[model samples]
Target: MTILHLALADDWTAAVDAGEYRVSTLGRTLAQEGFIHACADLEQLRGVAGRYYGEVTEPLVVLAIDEELVGCPVVREIPEGAQEAFPHIYGPLPVSAVVQVTPFRR
Candidate 1:
C-alpha cells in the first residue's frame, strides 16, 4: 500500500540529505508529534492541506511512500474529534521508503 505525506520542499530536501525524514507535520517534529501524519488518498490529502496548511506560502511536495519499503510501523487511526482514519508512521520515515516526490500545486 502507498501512503502520502505533504512536506515542505526544504524539509524534504533536508531529509534527502540526512537520509531520513523526522518532521511529523508543518511545524512539528516527530519527537514533538509522536507520529508522522499521512493520507490514504488525494481527496483526504486536499482536506488536510486546506485545513492545516492553507495559509502557508512555502513550496510543498507530496511524498508517495511505499508501505512495504518503510521499516517503521504504519497504523491507521482516527484522530480526536475526527471520524475518518488516517495513516500515521510510528517512527522516522526513511528516504528509501519514498517512491515519489511531486511538487504540490494546491
Candidate 2:
C-alpha cells in the first residue's frame, strides 16, 4: 500500500538537505506521537490537511510513501469520530521510502 503524509515544504527540504527525515510533525516527531502519521488515500488527505493545517501559510508537500519499503509497521485505524481509517507508520520515517513528493495547497 502506498500511503501519503502531508508535510511542510520547509520541513521536507530541511530533511532532504540533512540526508534524513526525522521530524514527524511541524514541532514534534515519532518520539512524541508514537507514529509518523499518514493518510490511507487522497480523500483522507484533503480532510486531514484542512482540519489540521488550514491556517498554515507555508507550502505543504504531499509525500507518497511506498509502504513495502518502510521496513516498519504500517497500521490503519480510525480515530474517535473519523469516518476513515488512516495509515500511520510506527517508526522513524526514512526519506528513501518516499517515492514521490508534490506541492499541495488549499
Expressed as tens digits, the lDDT of each residue in 19-78 for candidate 2 is: 666666666777887888898888888988888888888889999999998888989988
lDDT value, residue 76 of candidate 2: 92
Q: Which stretches of candidate 2 lie over 4 Å from their true place?
A: none
Strongest candidate by lDDT = 1
Tens-digit lDDT track for model 1 on 41-92? Answer: 9998999999999999999999999999889899999999889999999999
What is the C-alpha RMSD, rounded to one decimal, of candidate 1? Answer: 0.5
Model 1: CA > 4 A from native: none
Q: List per-candidate RMSD values in Å.
A: 0.5, 1.4
- Candidates in order have lDDT scores of 0.96, 0.84
The per-candidate count of clashes, in order, stands at 0, 0
